[model samples]
Target: MTGDAEPASDERTPGRRRLARTVLTGAAALGAGLVSGPGPAPTATGSAGAASSDATRRRPAGPDTALRELAEGNRRWRTLHERHPDETSTVRRALLGGQHPFAVVLGCVDSRVPPELVFDQGLGDLLTVRSAGEVLDEAVLGSIAYGVLELDIPLVVVLGHQSCGAVSAAVHADLTGTELPAHMQYLVDRIRPAIDPKLRGDARVDAAITANVLLVRALLAAEPELAARIAAGRLAVVGARYELGTQWVHRIG
Candidate 1:
């Protein structure tokens, strides 16, 4: 991770190439016969099948492909047409060799809004990071950077949701000036600035949730590690909000 004050605009192309090689080596070792399952037996070294699968999977998804896949998957989810791709033993075995997930989702730590479920993607398909209110922190930023910079994931989605408890709490605190507990207060403090002081109740919380997603998206787009990729058209950062009742995710930003 680079300094938060400015984008790390130094020449990263050569370094990215080096990192790709390193990841290939590390992935091979990590994937060999380490997976636990009732499925296919593991070979002493990895099977040729896994290698082939890895090769096919390693083709980096472009931003448009990534977005289209997610939108199609979400449609399946909301329509109860989910195919639940990639959960099979074969897919798991292939993943033992390496993961080439297409997107990075920075979403709330809310139970109802699991990224995999919302997008209807299976294992090894997404690199997901979560926090209450999707707050930005060093760890979260580093995780996202690893996916975009190392894994070469092309899409990053900042996922917010309706009736978010974190944003609701922040709205409550802002309206009444009632301080939350120390740790929870940390989440509120991070979220408070995104809320509109004039809006009240549900409207305030709903607007704040969308604002928070945009805020995180902006922060990511400005990040040195990610910004260069965006400029080169190698990566995209988007904002979306999930409706719990309809089980649909709508692009908000």
Candidate 2:
């Protein structure tokens, strides 16, 4: 969750070794492959083992309590502390056929803004979608709806970040008539309406980021399936911003 890289295998403790073995065996049966599309099957236990091993090392708790845990984990990350718990093989093997992630996050496509790292979560913990400016386009909305209705994820986070380049571009285009390419301009066009004309300078950027987060939250809450779940008190949506310099997230609502 801290966005820190995984520790070396030699550094792993005895408990971690046992867990890794379990995850690997399961991955073998499931025909686990890399993040990329399916390729050749794992050749040896060592290869298959690496997949589950990595997964076990990163696996987090169920979705029901994931958000609260994420907030707590972020605090630990900011404090430069490590709990260093190991995910057991039993748990890893059991989860091969199914997973129940707790929360869904709509974040920006910025490479530096990975939600798992910022929130200090591991694999299988968050259902994540990334789009430039965290914009609410049809595809993005559909993805969120799928997570809510099909996955039954309990919480949705609209994560905008500080000093977002996408928001800045939109602001610049609004100030000057300089035309952007049709495809790139589409992104600006979506973000432009979220900008508060009353605000200018740095405040303009900040307000635009916050407004976009709110707008996305509203859009998700208004989706028929998502809206019903929210009204029934079965789901919640919130907004936040990740500060690049500080490597921390501040909740906006």
Candidate 3:
């Protein structure tokens, strides 16, 4: 019995040693940036499992993967399955070292359409920029450029939402020829070109909303900094719309 036990113990010792070596090798790889760490893990909750599924998924390395992450997040949000991942103290502290956000979301400043909530992404997952009616200014453009040029974020999503007050206001001003207040007029002026004078009512407003998104996307894509990345296929620019009623976000451009 002792002789049989000795052989079994010897066999197990080598297996354990091999397992330890493998673990150490993997750890070294992670430390060296040769392997990416898993995304944030979520706390336990009924709806968290689905949201947290993304946390376990690999980090998005390019535009396509980043867009897919956003789509999945939006689905979880619309389905009432938001995981709200990566808001933990640990995740926050870890981010102090640096942020590695994969995408830039440029959306409306409307309180109801916060890009983070609409996409169901937590902190450090997205670099978000907002303006009324999704209008772009020099500052806003610079911010987006920083995300792409400095941060090397791969995807830029120009997000427009339904019933956007800014767009509606712009459309109303266009139809009536009533000038909005100075600053507000700036927003209107930016959005005015996209409005179709022939269309009226909700249809006009809706078309303007989508057109604004496309316009912003085009401007970003044409920027010298962003254009190079697009030409190299290292980046993508997309336009999407968020429905207030359904909480659904669909690409329009």
| Ranking, TM-score, top scorer first | 3, 1, 2
Q: For each candidate, how many residue pairs have backbone atoms clashing (under 3 Å)? A: 3, 5, 0
> Where does candidate 1 have its weakest 10-residue lDDT segment?
10-19
C-alpha lDDT of all candidate models, in order: 0.71, 0.63, 0.71
Error of 2 at 11 (Å): 38
Candidate 2 matches the true fold with a TM-score of: 0.71
lDDT of 1 by residue, 1-253 (tens): 1111211222111100011211112112112211111222223323454444533444336876777677666766766666566766777787899988999999999999999999878789999999999999889999999999899998888899878999998888878899898789888888876787766656677788878776777777778777777777788787777777666565645
TM-score of 1: 0.76
lDDT (10s digit) by residue, model 3, range 1-253: 0011111111111100011211211111111211122233333355445444544546689876777678767766766667786776566777899988898999888899988888778879899999998899999999998998899998888898878899999999989999997699999999987787777678788778877776777777777777777777788877777778766666655
| lDDT score for residue 82 of model 3 | 74
1 or 2, greater by lDDT: 1
Question: How many steric overlaps does candidate 1 have?
Answer: 3
lDDT of 2 by residue, 1-253 (tens): 2233322222111110012211112112211211111123323333345445544454333332455566655544444442322234554665687776677899999998987777656556678999999988788888888887898877788888878889899988988866798788888888886777777687777778777776666666667786676566677676666766555565544
* Model 3 misplaced regions, further than 4 Å: 1-57
TM-score of each predicted structure versus truth: 0.76, 0.71, 0.79
List candidate 1 stretches off by more than 4 Å: 1-60
